[model samples]
Target: MRPNRVSLVMSWLAMLLMGLAGLFGACGVSAASAAEAPIELRQGTVTTTVDGVTRTEPVELSYHWDRQHNGRPGTASFDLPFTLEAEPETPWGIFIPRVGNVFEVQLNDALLQTYGDMKRNNDADYAKAPIYVPVPGKLLRKGDNLLQIRLHADTARLAGLSQVVVGPAASVRNELFESANAWRFTGSVLLMAFSLIVGGIALALWLTQLDVDANGMPRRVAIYFWAALAEFFWAVRMADGLVAEPPLSWGPWGVLMAACYAGWAAASMMFVYHLAGWANERRHRWVRWPVAGVVVGTVLFSALSLQRDEPAWFTAWLAVELVFVAAFVGAFALATLRHPNDDRLLMAGAALVTVAFAARDWLVVRLSDAYGETTWVRYSSVFFGAVLLLIVLRRFRAAAVQARGSVAALAERVAQRERELAATYAELEAAAQVQARTHERERILREMHDGVGSHISSAIRQLQSGQSSSGDLLRTLRDSLDQLKLQIDSIHLPPGDVGALLAAARYRLEPRLASSGIEFEWAVDEVEPVEGLDAHGMRQLQFLLFESISNVLRHAEATVLRFEAGMKGKTVQLRVIDNGKGFDTTRVMPRSLAERSGAIGARLTVESRPGRTVVQLEFD
Candidate 1:
């Protein structure tokens, strides 16, 4: 759903341009006679035309051998012999592609063109579609001239079909040149357009607010930028000389063209290297060396100011260029076979470049002699370039989408963590509030114990010393002082059951239980309010509970204890029963009663059984 508008538009434009290229390929005339040249003719097809040249006009020059002439596989000769009334001003030429069998062209019954062995299989590729060659302009005389062609279409070459056409040498030559021009110009335009679009998008991305920390660097976009620059220079050379006469100087022009191509190729290869997960350690380093060398060499050659033209140097450069392309292409093919990312569109685009470039170059070389306007080399390159451009654009878009998704996921995780932090902070604040209130209460209790308790003690001392008091009044004053002292010393606990505190105490005493051979168990079903308890009281109760558990373990040698906490009306019940030796509850009862007359005495009921004693305590 994260649509990058730049990538989207780039992808669409590249695709539309590529489609236009394909459509452009399908245009033009496919004539039956020699007037319309054969489209994409091969080796064997060339021989058929050679044989048909012997006969005059109205001759059946068709490759549909299966229809009539028996479907037998063998050499067949046909003729389209022409008789000249006067010497023609324009030179004439015929395009005879290699057919499946051996073929020879004869003018005035003289040998003109011959290819392949008579014994070779008709299934050979060279015989299928060879380049068109021009006939010598001097061959035509004032009188009649016979063109006899011989073709071995069966068992002589690969599946080859031939088309023979005769036209003015100048016109055919121009057409031959035009075909190359078509591919070059068209390819240049497409490449330039794509480069511009991709470059613009990459620049835009570079300018955008990117989540770099989480997403890593956008290396793919960077590669695309370099590729666009390379393609721009590449288009310049091809487009500049497209319609220019003399085809511009080949040396400087070739160097620039080669450099551009190498740059784009290297950039594309690097992009795939990273995109396909092959950009690791040794591989990346190894591939980059050759790419760099090629770019450097191309630039150097482009700048050299040598006036003398060396075709050999250019040819050698081309050979090296081809080798370089092959090396990267081989690596890419292997990568494609191993890749499981399912980026087939990209793979297909790269494959087309391989086939188109290889095929176009091959044809241009073979058909150098009989070159005409309707050549296939020119169209294929430009058209396929456009196709590949579009493919890369689509892949770029996909990468953008993946990046956006990762960003969104990271954002969600961050939000969740923020919420958790906020909740923790809230709990911390509440605990802090409770602590503040407890501190205030503790301060008040300390003041009362120091100030009020002193005054009461002084009053009791005065009364006992016979300072104007009746006996009943003196007794009442003494009881009031005792009550006031008790109240001041007592602590306030939080208004909550003691289950949580008891659980914590037990958790801490587990080690003691283990050493004393005691099994402790506890359960809390309900937690009632501590009606009069406050924070101070809760702290005092916790400390007392710990001290009692310690005494049972140390003095009574308790083996097993059961602690239960539950709600009983408005009071919280906390009980601990232990199996241990019995203690003298009556002896301590009197001392505890004498120590605290107004308060209930600490009560202990010890029941001794066969092997154990039980004692319990309860507080509200």
Candidate 2:
């Protein structure tokens, strides 16, 4: 489970407890009724022993039983309807039970003892006696006196008391201590059982909603559920109050409680680690070290159970557990401080549990009687249940967020793939166009080879077959074939240096210019080396040039035609200028169309000027 899930669950439990606090108020009589509440307020006498001199003063006595007890008064060992006074040289002594729990004593209503010890009066059972203390003389005055005692009930006694007296007396009713014990057992049992039920419900929900195999929820949550169940059973046994045997003495309840607590501690840590995206093998080392120490301590403590009355052993265990709590709280604080967005829910849950458990445990240890009388245990359990609920809800939210991010990322990848596919299709279309042009040029080349070259070969053969006496028909055919071959060669030959190709064409055209009575002026620059043109491109340029010159020579009746060709940047520029009877450009449409379409007479045009026409070509 995610930490947020744990947080949400715990938060819910806390809210529920707050809602149900009224229920606990109806449980039973308050545990504090037996001792402290019986002491009535009264006036008192006191004597102060200062610098070896005795001085008298009047004092007052008053006491309030713990409020949770509904104001029931208790009986003191001494019958307290009477009042007596003692001086500084001789002060009153009072005996109050419910020690080993809590008490505050006063002489003549002046504060004297803050915390007093349990009367060594009980034989190991702690059920045998009441607490007793001697008040010092300095706290007394020589007059009518007042005395007060405030007691918090424990397992030994539930009534609180205070009085002014100077005698050893015992009360007839010993039911106060017995009642306190009974209340503690009942309260602990109910609280434990309720916690188990809550834990079980969470487990059932987790099994259904969480992907345990993929998310590791079963292992994470089962340990806590079972542990809590075991604790609940143990508490049930405790509630039965088996006076003849030790509580949790049989079966594996002790081991189970230890295991449950350990698992809870570990699960809490693991939940945060995974939720905040800091999961790693190394994190277990930090989490498990303290758990292991607890395991060892529990084992050792169990062995020492034969001497369970030793307060040191109990104190040591309590101290060790406190240390574990401290460590876990530190880790919780660190996680919250470092990653609030990711760990906020978890930290909130942990903090709730921490506060609830701490208050409950404090009362159990420091004021066991008060806690037993009050409803703290039930309240703590309810708070924990609500917190866990909050954690579950938040886990669902975080998972949804993660899912959305994954979906968005997947969509972006698909869109990019579609764009790549579209670009690939465009490249294929351009390649198809190039292929179609290649097929057309190949057909043209084939026709020239078969029709023109074959005809020329046939004429030569006819001349040879005619017995060396060729007629004019055969001779004329041979001459025509030669001219055709020359024209075809111009189209067939591979590309050459643009400068040289232009120079050769200019030289050949000069005679034609002379025949036409036109002067040819040529200007060609020293062109830089350039990539060659393909066969189709060469044929196109040659045809354009031939048509343009023919138009000037045949129709223009011009005196001069100027030709220029040169490399300009990456492009080759060519211009043909003629002094001719130029037609209007608008009226030259049919001729320009025929020339571009490769008809016999039409040629591409330049914009017409008053006296000259120019045609230009640019090649990349």
Write model 2 residue lDDT over 1-620, tens digit each, in one string.
69999999999999899767755543322322222122333444433232244445454432222322322222221112333332323233554433222445656556666553333211122221343455665554434554544333321122333333333222212344334444554455565566566556546545654334555554443333433343344334333322322244322343444444444544554544454444445655566566556656765653353233233343457566666666666666666676675335545565556655655564554344332223343345445445554565566566558768877998999999989988998898899889988986775666556445565676677677775445443533543443354355565455645565566567566775675578989887776533555554454455556557766765676899998878778666778888888877775643543444343222343666667887876555
- Candidate 1: minimum summed lDDT over ten consecutive residues — where? 37-46
Given candidate 1, what's the lDDT at residue 20?
92
Error of 2 at 572 (Å): 91
Q: How does candidate 2 score on lDDT?
A: 0.50
Local distance difference test, each candidate? 0.51, 0.50
Q: For candidate 1, what is the total of clashing residue pairs?
A: 59
